[model samples]
Target: MPETTAASSRTGRLLAAPLALILSVGSLTACGPTDDGPHADGTRPSSVTSPSVTSPSASGPSAPGAPSVPAAGKTAGTGPTTRHTASSSPAAGRDPDDPDDRLHQWMESGSIPMNASYHWPMLDTSARLADGEKFLFEEHCGARRTPETDSLARAAWMEKARPGKNDGDQNWLAQETIAAHLQDGKRKASALFGGLAKELQACGSAHTSVTYTTRDSRHVAATIVLDKDTARPTTLHEYLAVVGDNVLELSLWATPYHQDGGNKPDVAWPGPPDTSVFQAMTTPVCPQGKQC
Candidate 1:
């Protein structure tokens, strides 16, 4: 990634953390669209290059002992209300009936509640044809081979800001979702999820611990607390859910201490935002052309 300024350099570092999760996908044979294109098994068109991660200024770290969810019926914002910094709606003129558009809609709506919760201005967002294999395999998160499926659509969002009271404090969160065309949605979901579970297993060690809150055939959720043995630890809550032919990946990252050596924020880390909207991506009715 090229950087013209210190801010861009820092953003790249921060973006890499989330993109690293993409690398864990390994080989996903039988995972992509069967229509004409680069085989989903791991090849990318020569034209498209891997995306670069980027960062922004700072926000305070997660408060010690923050609650993971807000009280029932209440939204999750902890500080005084802040003006919305970004729009969560889909672009105008998109065909509502297009399969890709439907997938984009799912990704956008699922993020609205979360974005509204903490004034987490959207730093970046992307909706593109699925082409993460080359990038994912490069990370080598213990997959035997790279995944081969080209999703019908893939969407990603990055949110970060200085929503804290202290200078140089920061909070970051990201979510990515992919919808594939598959004959057996359940089986494909299970297989891809196995890869994710494997990566999570490999990611745990002395510096970090993984605690799963939900694990089953269609959905999996876990929380990882890092640097727990040391001061200024951080937490990352991860979720994976397969709805029909769509799968959602979300990460809530909270640093309990400032990376810039600034004081902690006055507010607590607002835990994982509600994900029911994402969990329902393919329900009520499947996408126009999807097998689900």
Candidate 2:
């Protein structure tokens, strides 16, 4: 086969699997008809592509010392609170329900419409965050956009290898499916992305107040964190963007300390690159900006 054809064929499997998990939440449960939202004609341009999937780089569980989940209802950020941020007011229009947009693709399949750094089996272990981190992830975890958020609908997720069972990959997975309230043709999805950025910031900030010794830095489009102090050193990165009435967010966590070969891995911390998670979130622009 020609090089171009062969390359496409090789990547096909990487893009097709793992879609089931992203779209499993079948109910459109929270949206109403568009009164003053999206295009006046109720139409959006066709999307050139749909949501794609990226397999993990082989998996295991949580970080080195992340504690197991405690009994339900015992965690931080437990109650809902009215929160505000700069330029984060959600619009009042309904997001357009286009079947071909990236949001729809994600809704149809529980998958991140992007390829992972490498493909590997999903780690069979359960989520395990440190005592404080666990509370933050299971409870304060900002992926779950709150009711105060201007989102009419949303889906959030994270995938990681069990720290002990993992095969030494340096990444995990995270995703959020957000449907924003649109108004006057603009989807105002940016507010949703902004909201998520704020949540992650809050999460990172909480890290300092807690006992976890995670090290982190921010990139233009995403944030990267390293946890070498744990039994298994892990790396995590994520990015978020708004598309029409939808916001796509992706995060990846990995553990490569086994390869570093030391109690404190000597590998130099590298800035997170523009991974497919970044590319997928940035792509899929609708002319009206709210239809996706």
Candidate 3:
């Protein structure tokens, strides 16, 4: 999730690159805390390094074809909007209740939960970036490609829990999720979740470690601590679950650091929230053979 901008200085770029990836995916709008405590700003530094999450051929952020990064204190572009419309008609002689067709329709508009989970605020697609409603095939963590999920229907959503005023200090929680249909869901879920876990493990000097994990037939969740070699390290949580042929993914990123305080940030985070909350959230989206 590295940003895609040239930095004024190498140190600035190095300092910014590690933090840009996920922030770039967000609004990058910096704001001040409305309350009395240290807050984390969901903004990106001026410089960016675009680690190609979708393509491996391209070198790191410095390579050509990297998207341009916005200047410091500016909002990151949300890319083009994409609308996913389920097929209106089924093939001739095919049952109207066809699982694939139902899956497609459910994935296009029915999987995400709008309610808050694990202390995170309610998620709103409208409150996200410009193209927040779009369905995405790309992975947030730098994964080469999701195995066995090509050409499948997918849905994605992202939102910030608390967007404070534009006063340069802020504390926010960023969250996103993806739902898709797979032929071999169990295998596909493992492949998808495994790829993400592998990529996240490479973060930081000692690399991020799995602080907690839960695995069952219905879902798998893992929380990792991204102690990157920077002034502020982030805590990222990811969850993956399978219900029949449907697979769902949820991710959360939060870092509480203030601009004025520099290296010393307030340790007020409520620890990594449980990702299992999404396991139940996925059932209603793609339950059994019924369309949601």
* Consecutive 10-residue window with the lowest summed lDDT within model 3: 155-164
Ranking by lDDT: 1, 3, 2
Per-prediction TM-score, please? 0.44, 0.36, 0.40
Off by over 4 Å in 3: 1-124, 127-141, 146-170, 183-205, 216-218, 259-276, 286-292
Clash count for each candidate, listed in order shown: 21, 27, 5
In the range 105-205, model 2's lDDT, one tens digit per residue, is 23211124223333333222222211111111323343445564423232211112222222344334443333433442233445544555555656554
Better of 1 and 3 by TM-score: 1
Candidate 2 steric clashes = 27
| Selected candidate, larger lDDT, 1 vs 2 | 1
Expressed as tens digits, the lDDT of each residue in 1-292 for candidate 1 is 2446878889899999878766655333256443336745667455543233112222333345743444445566533232222323222233434554434333433343345545544322334433333112112223343242222111122111112232343344444445343335556655655666666656677877778877776666677776767767666666666665445565555565555554333344445433464444344335546665
Among residues 3 or more apart in sequence or in different chains, the pairs in candidate 3 whose N, CA or C atoms overlap within 3 Å are: 1-21, 2-21, 31-169, 32-169, 50-61
Instruction: Supply the TM-score for candidate 2.
Output: 0.36
Q: Mark the regions of model 1 whose C-alpha exceeds 4 Å error after superposition.
A: 1-102, 108-117, 120-125, 128-130, 133-170, 183-185, 230-232, 256-267, 271-292
Quote the lDDT for 274 in model 1: 36
lDDT, residue 179, candidate 2 = 40
